[model samples]
Every structure is written in C-alpha cells, then in structure tokens.
Target: MSEHDKPGRIAPYPRPAGGWDAIKFSAASLRQEKVVLGNLKAFLKQNQPHGFDCPGCAWPERRHTNRLEFCENGVKAVAAEITSKLVTANFFARHTVTELMRQSDLELEQHGRLAVPLRYDPTSDTYRPIEWDQAFALIAEQLHALDSPNQASFYASGRTSNEAAYLFQLFARLYGTNNFPDCSNMCHEATSRGLPGTVGIGKGTVTLEDFELADAILIFGQNPGTNHPRMLGELRDAARRGATIVSINPLRERGLERFSSPQHAAEVLAGGSTELCSLFIRPSLGGDFALIKAMAKRVVELDDAACATGGERVLDVAFIETHTVGIDEFLADLRQESWSLLIEESGVPREEIERLTQLFVRARSVIATWGMGITQHRRSVPTIQLLSNLMMLRGQIGRPGAGLCPVRGHSNVQGNRTVGIEERPTAAFLDRLAAVYGFEPPREHGLDVVATIQAMLAGSVKVFFGLGGNFVMAAPDTPRTFEAMRRCALTVQVATKLNRSHLVHGQQALLLPTLGRSEIDLQEGIEQSVTVEDSMSMVHLSRGFKPPASDQLLSEVAIIARLAEAVVGNRLVDWRALATDNSLIRNHIAQVFEAFTDYNRRVAAPGGFHLGVASRDRVWKTASGKAQFVVHPLDLDTPIHRARRQYGDQAMVLMTTRSHDQYNTTIYALDDRYRGVYGQRDVVFANRRDIDRLGCRPGDRVDLSTIWDDGIERRLNGLLLVEYDIPLGCLAAYFPEANPLVPLDSVGDESNTPTAKSIPVRMLPHLD
Candidate 1:
C-alpha cells in the first residue's frame, strides 16, 4: 500500500473550508489592491539593475526599456522575498518543527520572510535562533566529520546568481563531492541531457529577437498565462501580427485560447482579449513523441508528392546536406509509423496532423517553444530531438525567426547549468578549471536529484545542503523524500521564505535566511550587482532597491562564502574577499569559465550581453559535428492488470496539473479563475462520458489509486467530480495534491523526471 493509504494519513482531497463565496471574497479582497507602483518603480530602477535576479520564471526582459518589466506573479515573488514581515527566533520558539509541518504550504508562505539563522533543537522540538558564526561552525563540524566527500550532496536552486552558482560548484568539488543535485534535475534535466546530443548545446538555439520575426510558432505543453505571464504579451503581439501560433497540450488552457494583456490599455478597457493559438491540438499526456512522429510522416509524404508534381521541395535539401546527420534513419522510422496507432496514441486525428505538417511546410520561418509539460515525461529527450528534427527538415535553425526555445521557469536555471551545476562535468570544463583555478575538478559523474534522494534512503548520503530550493515538498513521493531527508545527519537550507522543506528535519537542521533580489545587497560598503541568464540565454544584471527586511539576513553569496570558509578553509580560496566584493567573484569566474571572459566590463554596459549560441552560426557541437536526428519507435503494449481478472476493464490515465492561481509549490489562492474552478482545490476534471461509464456523476467523491506493478495504492478521498470537455478515458487534477499517486520510481525514460503528466489509476466511490 502507498503511504497515503495508511490509517492516519491525510486524504488528498480536503473539503472546501469556507465554500465558494468565501473564496470569492478572499479573491475580491485584492480588487482594491494597494498598488506598489511607486515603490515598484523606484525599486526597479535602483535594485533591478544591480540586484540579485528575480527568483521567478526565466522569460527574457523587453529590452530593459522601461522599469515596468515584471509581472503580477513576479511582483508577488519579489514582495515575498523583500517583505517587511519577519520570521524571527521568537516565532520559531513558539512553534515546533512538527507543528510547522502541520501548516499548509500557503500558511507557511504567509509566515513571512525568514529573518535570522535558526537551528532545530530536539529537546524543545522548536527552532531556536543561532548566531551565524555558530551555524557555520556547526555545519563545518558535520562536513569535516563526513568519512568521504561522496557522502554529501550539494543541492542548488535556479534562483542562485552566476557568481554564487560558480562558487557553489567550486565548493562542492573542493570539498571532494561531485554529488550536485539541483532544481534542473526535477524540471528540464531532459533538455540539458538530450539536447546536447542533437544540437551541440543543451540550451535553446533562438534569441528573443527571433520571436519578433517568426512567421509561425508552435507552443507545446506550456501555458503562458499563469507560469510565465510576461510571455503572453509576446505571444499576443505575434498573433496580432498574423503569425500562425499553434498550441499543443493535454488541457485546453484558456491562456492559449485568448489573452487580454493588462499592459494593453485599449484592449483591457474594451473587454477584448486577443485570440491566441490559431490551432489547438489536445494530445494525450506523454504522447508528444507519437504526435510529432505523425507530423513528420506527413511532412515526408508531402515532400515526395511535391517532387512528383513539379512543386518546390518541402524539405530543405541544401541545409540537410550541409548541417545534419541521421535524417534517413529518422525519416524511415516516421514512414514506418502507422496512422491508426498515431491517431490512437496522440488523441489527434490524422487530418489534424496533415494540417499541422502543411502549415510547417508552408511557413517561411518557424519557432518551436515548449515548457515543463514536454520536458517532464518519459520520452522528453526524444521529444526534444523530434522537435529539432522537424525544424531542421525545413532549414529553420541558424536563421532569424526560426529555432528551438525551451521556456525555463527559474530566473537563472539555464545560467546555473551553464556555470557548472551539472552532475556530469565535461573533461574540457574540468581541464579549463584546473588550468585556471589551480585544482583538478572531479571527473566522476555526480548524483542528480533523484539519485541523491535514493542515496539518502540507502544510508549512503549523510549531509544535505540546499542553496535555495524547497527539496522535500517539491520532489515526488513526498513520504519517501521526507523520510530520506530526515535520515540525513545534517540539512541546511539557504532560503528567503519558510517552506515545508525547511521543517523536514535532519538530525540537525539549519535555516539560513538570505536577502531577496528586491532588497539592497551591501557588499564591502559598495553597491553590487548580480547577473542572471534568462530563458533566451541573455545574461543581464539585476540590482535590488529596498533595504533588507532584516539586518541579520545575509546575501546568498555571503552564506556560501561563510560556509566555504568554515569547511574548505582560507587556503583553497579567499571566501571573505570574494564575499566582500562581487567583482572578485566575477574575476574568479572569468578565470575558470571562458564564457564569462571580461564579465565585469561586459555587464557594466546599458544592456547585459547574450551568451554565445553556437547554433546561431551553424556550429553544431554534437559528436558527429552535425545536428543529429534520433528515432524513437512507438511502443503500444499496455501492462496487464492482475486485479482485472476479477473485474475486467481498462484503467484510466490521470494527468496532474496546476491551478492558474498557483506557482510551483506556492498556492496564491484557491480559485482557478480562468478554468471556472472556484474556491475548490479538490475537484477533478473529467469527461461526462467517463463519469457515466464509471457509475458516477458530477459532484461525486471518488478515490483514485495508481495501478502500478509495485503493490502501491494511493487514494484521494472525497474528491468532487466536475464534468468537463476532456477526452474520454482521461482525467485531470491539480498537482502536489495529486502528487502522492506518482511513484518516485515512475520517472522519464532518459531524463529521470517523474511522469506526473501521465499516471494510470483505478477509481472507486468514496464509500466512507
């Protein structure tokens, strides 16, 4: 049985506490929303340029023209970071770790900003305030006592600045551990791992400038309205200019349907939202490979027909000859794919596939963009390769208005990977580091996020240090993750706010509060700026404006510096000097990484610089020295169910989703306004036919359990059913709430990302 099946476990669905009216009341409370425009403007100007990067999504800035670059969620993210509210020692003194664990994620966020360093005391069961020196000294003791560096894991968030990230990786290596488990492991690990094989670089090949010139755009498995709100503006402009924009996702997200940019005064006043997606393709969860293959097969047929009819060739013959390899194999696989199987798997008609292929064949330039939905799957890498292959067939790369764009969530997630947050370090990167930094970097591949958790569970990992992410709660299989964290000898979190992960205690846990991007970071009596790499691979400077919420709070850089000093000693590197002056940190970075050459001078300019994208110039960095096409054959075998011997029937597939009002792990409110979901987080969206087939109706409570090979069973008690326009035999529900049903072992084929988007489950009535 799954952990949730236990007697005392909390049910996945919680009854609506105050009802829809109460939720509406709470949402309406923001109508008279106190505008922080003045503060925002001043802060944007003073802090944005030189401050730490925003911890939100990695969508690029609009040329840094005006100060109003941030979005609503960005504001909340910033405010949450630079809030006046403080979580002092007194607050933690009153509540034990166990008590805090009982609080909802929203309540934990509402507890406000963490103000000082805290250490959990087992006797009192509360976190008592500890001095920074003491905290560092204690952490040092644990690190020193570790039998081997491999026993420790260093976890990082995408929010960390380039300088901090560089220092973090350096510290991990110098400390003798390459076990760097980071945020990338959970989200775009597939993109990082798979893209390099196809395109020389793991990052997106396109720049923001490419978006303006594209004739056609394909958005796959991403909702811009909620996750990356600012991107909606770009899509709206692109759609307005007559660009063909297609959206492919499991849900018919309203964001892809229409968007009224709050920035567009006339549009908002007229109650008009711009029409987005010219065509919306609803594919089955984890069915991207099937969909893309069907499209590819159609493209090949069109190419052959064109040649026979004295028409222009659909495929870019010259580009293919000069810049790519393995096309024949890929094309053969596509040609072999059966239309019936594609139709059944993709949940899209063959006609729709032809239409999409025709559009691709006709477009002069096309940009393919995708989000976590594509990356967080079993065939994530292969799916990405398929996208690259589709683009290459039309000679889309190495030109304006056409390329691949991976829409990352964190501000510097791409940057972190760029600067060396990876578990797998290249020999060239290590050689450069040794030549410049005077130390041989670890060559052995390190553990990723999943591997780290598994290591901890097996008693192989002892110390856990997170640079700035919520590890426990954000990871899949919460019960296992929490227990693994608890098994650690020590756990250290460098963060800006209180999260559930903070309460997932170790033998000794340290909560080291840090300054946010919106706050002034004073270093050595001089104002300093931190750099962040955006989704488009543009490296820009971010400076903060408001004074820090607490004087006790340290910058992320300072915390890392102190920790490094305590653990690695002053001989390896002067941590104090580097912390005192960010310039020193940049200089050190420049010495080790060739990409950051003259980092200080380049960032001093009005607009930050773009990291070199090799694909832009047709420099393929793959092993074959050409863009490679990978073939992924479709597998249609469904696992047989032993329980079905007693009652024969097909199991349903459920995709976990997020509400419009929520960000990853942080629920802003209960209402999912865009989808017409109100004050109800426990409702599951299903097709009316499916409900009837299951002997249920709308508003019926049902228990959903996963049908996995392992005898694990997860149930969501009292989940209200809502009839929706979803496909038959398919179900959708919000994540974290439904996360319990996803087994940690049920991960992506190559990426190791949990298949949260596609889980097979059996349902039962809520008899209790």
Candidate 2:
C-alpha cells in the first residue's frame, strides 16, 4: 500500500483552471501511468463517436469532430485505466489482506489493476490466484445454498455498461430477488426518485445542444473543476456566450471562479482564462432548500410587481396553465415562506437572493443544474422539487434552452437505471421482462445500498456480489458497511483495480478482474461495442480499441453472463450466446424497453440516438399528465435541528467532497492542485473565522466527532485542520476518509441516498 504518511503541503494557487498547470499535470499523469506514446494516442480517442467512453464522468460529448472532447479528469481516468502497472497473483503473494488494509484509501487503489481472478485465503490472510470457472462455481454454490434468494445481495455500479446492467438486473429478477444495491442509491437517488413524479423523466431536460443557447445557468452543490472537469469547458463557453452563470455551494470552488481550457492552445500559452460564474453564492450545508425556496419567492415577487402595473408578466402564464398542476398551492406556500428563517438558514443575504431573482426575471432561458450538494441532504427530494418548480414557473422544461439538469456522476449511471438496474422494479417493466424472458420476475421491492447494508448487518445476507465500483469506500458509515460486508458468507468484486473494497472482505472473497472501458472485448472473433447513457438521455455506443490489459480479463457482460449460467443455468435465457455476441443482448434489451425500439440500428449510426424523453416532448408520463408543482414547507430536519440545539451554533456541518485528483472513489493523484493541498488526505478545510472561534490556528491538528441522534459517537482522530474559504461553521473534507462520520441511517426523504454531503460534526483541536 502506498500510504501518504508525510504531512500535506498547503500552498497558494494563483492561476485559474487550465493554463500551464493543466498541460503539466496531464503530462505527469501519462508519465506516472507509464503509458507508451502509441498506447496513449489510441487511448486519447476516448468519448469519440467510434471510440470508448471515458470512465471519469457522465458529461456528454459535444460532437464527433471536436478535436479534444476529454478533460483533465478524463485524461487522468484514461491513464489510470490503461496504466502499464499491474497487480498480479505474484504481487498479491507479497501482501496479505490484513497488511493491505493498513494502507490508506488512495494507496490501496494505486496498487494497480487486478490482472486475474483471486480468492482470499482467510487462513493465510492473503489472496491466491483462482480459475474463473472455479470462482464462479464457488459463488453459485454459496448463492444456491442460501435459505432464500433474498438472502443474496447483488450490487451494480454506474460504470457497468447498459447491456451488463440489463443482464445483471434480469439475472437477479429471474433468481427471485430484487436486491439490487447500486451506486445510484448513494449518489443521485434523489433525482431518480424526485424527477419522474414531476417531469415524467428522471434525467436532465436539457441536452448538450442546450448549453449553447442558454441565457443563464445556475450550478448548485457541485464542483466541476475536480468532479467533472469537462463541464468547465462548457461553462467557459457558456460564459463567453454572455450567459449569467450562478454558483451556489458551501465552499467556493475554483472552477466556478474561472477556467482556462487546455484544449485551446492560445489560452494555455497566454495564461488567459474565462471567468465562469457571474455570481457565486456560498450557502450553508443543507441550506440549498431554503436558498432555492427564497429564490422562488423572489421570482414570484418580481412577477407580481410586473403584473401590478399591467406590464409584461415575468411568469409564463399560458405555459403554466396548459402544462402544469398544483401551481396555486405551491405559490401560496412560497408566498408564506419566512424571509428571516430562510436568510438565517441559507446564510445568503436578502440582497443576494434579490439579485438572483432579478437575473431570473430578466432571463428568458435558464437551466438549473445541481449535483450531490442538493441531493445528499435530508430534504433532497423537496429541494429538487423546488428546483423543478423554479424551472416550470418560467416554462423551462420542454423549452429550447432551459430545464432541470441533475449532473450525474458516473459515465453510465443514468443508463444503468434506464436499462433496469433498480431495486424497485416497475410492474410494467417486470411484466415486460417476464414476457420476453419466459420467466417469473420478482415483483417485490428489493434492498437498495443502505437497506443492503442493514440486511448484511442482520446476518440475513450471505452472498454479496458487486458488478463494479469500490463499495466499501463509496458507502457511508464505512466501519458499519465493512462490518456488514464481513458478515457475508461470500463476497465478490468484479472490478478493474484493487481498492479498499477488495481488502475489506467477507469470510470468503473473490476478486474477479474485468476489462475496463478502454479495453476491447472480442467474443467469437467479433469485437464488441457497449452502450452507455449520458447525464442526458443520449444513448451512444462505446467501442474499445485497445487490447485487454491481461489475457485473463473478461468484459463485465461476459462475467455477468457466465456467473448467471453457473448460478441460474440458462433455462429461459441463453447466457452463452449473449456473452458471445453483444448484439443479442442489445436485441433482448430492445424487446423489453420501448425506448430502444431499434436499438441496434440506431446505435450503429454515427453518433447514436437519443431516447427522446417524454418531458422533453411535453408529454408527461406522471400521474397528473402535466408537470406537478410540489411544495415542501421550509424547516430544518429533526437530526440537523437537534444537533444545532445540542452542540451550539458553532457545530460545523461537514461535507465530504472529491479532491481535484479524484473521480468518485478512485484517487488518480494525491495532490488537490486547485485546493492547494498536496500529498495527503488527512487534512480538513474549514473557515478562518470558525478556526479562530474554536481557538485554533491554521494547520491545527484536530479530531472530528459526529453529533448523531443515536449517540454512536463516530470519531475520526488526528486530522489536520486548515483554515480556508468555507462558510463559518462549515467544514470540507475528502470522502472515504470522512465517510465514517456519515451515519448509515442518515438519508434523504424519498431518495434514501446517503447524506454524505452533509454530516453534523464537532471538531476540537488535538492537544498532542
């Protein structure tokens, strides 16, 4: 394990996004990954129309002809995926699981890609190489031996292809369980749960094309510079087009301040960058609801003032009447909202809200995009509703340049759910699956990620299988999730690299290495191209060109099919043929999903096809048959309100974020160049005022304890606190390191997504 034992270096970062730093860093990544220039050139075809999708983010490709579509983070992801480094059986022989567990999260993943199937040997505390057939057989035996199908839990990741995800869900349902715990359950479950009821679609209403025409774009609770670097390009472009870009977050993000696109040689050479955000608002953690509501109120006020003088109405009256429902009640609720409470909770001045209101009033087109910040709170569903309400008020949905965009994290996360990787399957979908596959599909609701954690803790779940992703690092309540995983009789991780999840194993664990997005999968001499849906509903084919890093590596589709064959034994489904030809899998997918009517033909086209969203067509599939305007009364939730009452007003609201060098759970580099922190993950970023208030100076060593309702007292000790530009009484730290502070039970109202973005913690200076 490559541990960052040395203290981190915090320095001043003078330049904006891009410039020489972008070029230098990307070059460093290629060098670190030991990629040959030829291989690197081939890998650079990522996200191309005829090439593979970058595993970094779900940001859609602009066009096939765009010289450089990938971003800095995308390059890092490609370098990591196509790295020359390998963690083979020989490497595993040198280290035990216990010994590996001692490595830091970043170090554990840097051990390199898993090259072969390896099973954990509990007696030796080491991983030994195993044959694929025997490994699948062991998993099948354990699963079959379970008292009930529900006793086994299956997890899918956002990285899984649409074909693989479809097959995985199909396998689970055929096996008589809906126990699908997926990455979506942790990230954007709020959007998945909140959007459909309102807009008839869970995905973003705006397309990549919309970015060009937007008058204003409001980004909330997300940092594009680190998490989704490609978005910074779009933001830069939008800003250059004179769009008013507004940023609402707990901490000021560099990407929002300004961006210099490395793709533009002139900008890099001249050190010139575009200022991205017109107005940057830092709301307190969990203050998004109040902020959104207040914005809505101001918009309505502006509309009323215009209507009073018999002037042009700010609200789209005709569109509202024809396409919306429950607006009257929603407006009433907004009108009655308390300004004092909203201002206090949101931590935004009334004048700032008024300024945004004026911008909204003036703008004819607006797109409100949000990320984990708005979704990882207790009131996420309501907060999303507030966003939807704001959009619909001005008839943003179905419009040319305005809509609701929930920036999805993974490359194909939205598509995974689109292709049926959900715990709660719709009866219509199940019926279609049963008819197509000639098997009785599971109708009962299954365990999501959090519920799966609880099930594992109860000792009911014996077999745990993950298609992709590092679950241990991704899940909240890290200690508890690890304990639950350990309770499983057998655990399986079908992945690209060795992460903390592989080391934190069950009684018996299997590390089944699989092909990454960058690697080609040929079955029966024919190369395969898998499809992935972007943040928008655009479904495109991703064809890998590079050979597999290891001959032993199998594609995720092959792995899932083989496992299903071993376990369920292809009575109704031809798992073998599906594995051999991906087209057959797509055909089967088309048969079940109406959106994929001509899936094969459409995907074969140049840029693939869009799954024409219903809301985009102004045909709502919702219960109302119109866009629904739902209102949530503004108030602090029980947990947060209680914590503030008990721990005083100074209690810091801790938010676990991705570093500049990370993409979700994968750490590409140790340095957070944008935040000016290098070679460490143990440091916490807090406000200067808060540090002074707590009687601490910059770089003071501290320990943070979660102020939980259950009083479990989850504590992360020996953390170095750095006073920085965050809201007072708010702290920012990178995740998996801070995952333990997020309680398992702390979830959103309807989404049930882990509240990883907001955890109430009290940090004290370490005397030692």
What local lDDT score does residue 218 receive in model 1, on the 0 to 100 scale?
94
Error of 2 at 120 (Å): 1.3
How well is each residue in 552-575 modelled by candidate 1, as lDDT tens digits?
989888999988999988886999
lDDT by residue for model 2 (484-563), tens? 99999999999998888998888999999999988889888989999999998888889888889999999999999999
Q: So what's the TM-score on candidate 2?
A: 0.98
Q: Against the true structure, whose lDDT is highest?
A: 2
Q: Which stretches of model 2 miss by more than 4 angstroms?
A: 1-7
Q: By TM-score, who's the top model here? A: 2
CA-lDDT, candidates in order: 0.80, 0.87
Clashes of each: 10, 0
